[model samples]
Target: MSAKKRERPPVPEILPAPVVDSHTHLDACGAETAADVAVLLDRAESAGVTRVVTVADDIESAKWVVDASTWDSRVFAAVAVHPTRTKDFDDAQRSGVERLARAERVVAVGETGLDYYWDYSPPDAQQDAFRWHIDLAKRVGKPLMIHDRDAHEDVLRILEEEGAPDDVVFHCFSGDAEMARRCVDAGYVLSFAGTVTFKNASTLRESARFVPRGQFLVETDAPFLTPHPFRGAPNEPYCTAYTVRNLADLREEPVEMIANAVRETAERVFRLPTVTRG
Candidate 1:
């Protein structure tokens, strides 16, 4: 017998206001060309996910993301060599990422930081690459998008040591309430992904509740982390609609309010152009 295939969740109703998926992987989400990107974005727009910041995880993706951003007005890009891939981040890789980071549509330098869960890259190498990315963000005047997994303490210490960029966002933030508070105090924005909607993610839920407006954002990290009820299903930018609704319920705020707050925060943090809905 064959294993069952998970069904993709039906797109939730359009949000009351537009929101942004602060981080995602268009390439990983099965988009290979401009038309494929459009199909996904079209679904997202219907659900009121007006814009997205597609992030890169390696040198090839860094280049692809920059090109994808140019293919559509609603798409923006973030380029970085993810922590696990930094084991052999040579000069060519560094220069490639740096060059792409300067692209007009590349709004942030990130999906970078330490990942202790995977032993793919040694801690020392990850830390070194992280520091370099921090400086790159500062030099390019862009927000630093982080990918902190289980190495919260080290990630924080390194940021303090390197003098974090003007804007820093912990993408798919996995810390507890105290860590959230620390990041908030330091003016670092926490971006919640579908994990916050999991039944067992009480700590993440608590952090979501604790983060004040303007200090937090939402993302799909899609092609992964599909919101609950659709947990194992394939995820895309459109699924962000489900997460946004769940967040409103979690925070006990109106849906439209949560939508507007994250949208505004993303625009300011990424310096993205204001998206006016027709």
Candidate 2:
């Protein structure tokens, strides 16, 4: 007999207030068409995740995310060639990402930075791509959403060398308290993913706890990093609720306060318009 399929985690209770998933990959989560995207967003909305910024990690996904943003009023897009995929990031790819970055629905230039954890791309190439993206974000006057993984030093160095953009977000921030302090001091927002709720993530939890309300945001980074208890389960934007609650409990703050803080920070950083739910 075939092995039984694992079930998806049930959606957590609705948040006290709506929150935004700062980064996710709807395409990777099996969303192909507008209807498919809507289905995912519907589930998220029911759990009070009223808005999302779907990020692209490659040229094709860059185009898809821009198009997907138009499919739903609550969806936004962030475009860039992820560091791991930057091994062959030529002029054509850069231009393609640039065009998509200017899309009305595209709010940021990101998921770009060094990922030393994965040996998919060399350090020089990743740094080169990271610098280019930083410049692109500056030229476009949009926030830069970074994906630093085991490469915090080089990522920070490159951003400084490139004269860093006005707004920067460390998506799925994995650094400890000291790094968090550095990022916050530099005025860069740290967007926490489900990983922060992991039982063994004490350092990460410390970072999360100390980040001021306006300096932090929340995300699902879905189809990956499902919050604790559902750690390995299929994740989606709706799972953001669980992370929010966990963050509140960890920070010793009220759920509504955490929800409102992240929502406000997301709107300001992404320049998203206020969303209303019936």
Point out where model 2 deviates above 4 Å: 1-5, 276-278
lDDT of 2 by residue, 23-137 (tens): 9999999999999999999999999999999999999999999999999998999999999999999999999999999999999999899998899989889999999999999
lDDT of each: 0.94, 0.93
Predicted structure 2, TM vs. truth:
0.97
lDDT of 2 at 189: 99
Model 1 misplaced stretches (Cα beyond 4 Å): 1-5
Please report how far candidate 1 places residue 195 from its true position, in Å: 0.2
Write candidate 1's Cα lDDT for 22-92 as tens digits: 99999999999999999999999999998999999999999899999999998999999999999999999
User: Worst ten-residue run, lDDT, model 1?
Assistant: 1-10
